[model samples]
Target: MARLRDRLTSLSQPRYLAWRALPLGSFDPRFARLRIRTLVMEWHRTRETPDDKAWCEQTLEALGHEVTPGIWSGEVNGLLWARPRESEARR
Candidate 1:
């Protein structure tokens, strides 16, 4: 039946994967970096404006992430690295 198929599809989806992938307790620098890189790539692909970039940066800051320039694949790019803010790290 259609309802049964829909239920099977929902069950097959990795719904809990996001929770499992998240760090357990303490801040995760690697995860932060990856998130920043993903955001940067999305911005590039979408040709986001500077205002949008700034908004993203602000959101990261609000979430206790510090964005910085770093070398990625032998090239310098802004937001290549993201780490927990010093204040957040001590907690």
Candidate 2:
């Protein structure tokens, strides 16, 4: 199954392994969630093309996320927050 394959792939990633190895008893759940979200956003930003805003929009839509545009350092940029598509959200 795709989920299983994805899990397996994550297990092999050092960053995922390190995150998993954090002491759960001492780790704040809110901080953990924020850290993961920030990492994912940074990953997307690294792949973003400065001149190609459309590419960013299309990529996020395909991944079922709605993005908000923001001003960053005089450039129009995005602050991404992941949410399910309307059809999926109703379910």
Candidate 3:
């Protein structure tokens, strides 16, 4: 069971550095504005219940992204989100 958990956890790990027309180390400020959604549900290995989904959604909102019901290309293709800082929530 532990091995399974570890494997599942690793599934959410970042596989590649770039996709979605995003480049490697481009340093483009425009891409900086994009909000990336995180798969917080992946934190637990058992399951993704409604409460878990809500928690993920709320967490994303707290992060300031207008997250939808589906995973973003960033989360799907790559294991990264150029997430904005918490300071942005104050503005």
Error of 2 at 15 (Å): 6.9
Clash pairs (backbone) in predicted model 3: none
Model 3 CA lDDT for position 47: 33
Better of 2 and 3 by TM-score: 2
Task: Tell me the tens digit of each residue's lDDT in model 1 across 1-91.
Answer: 9999999889777531222233433333444433322222222212323343344456567667776544442212233345677676766
lDDT, model 1, position 62: 66
lDDT of 2 by residue, 30-61 (tens): 43233222223321222333443455445555
Off by over 4 Å in 1: 1-42, 45-50, 72-79
Tally clashes: model 3: 0
TM-score of each: 0.37, 0.34, 0.29
**Sort by TM-score, best first: what order?**
1, 2, 3
- Whichever of 1 and 3 has more TM-score, that candidate is 1
Query: Which pairs clash in model 2?
Result: none
lDDT of each: 0.45, 0.43, 0.40
How well does candidate 1 match the true structure, expressed as C-alpha RMSD?
11.4
Instruction: Judging by lDDT, tell me the better candidate of 1 and 2.
Output: 1
Point to the candidate with the largest TM-score. Answer: 1
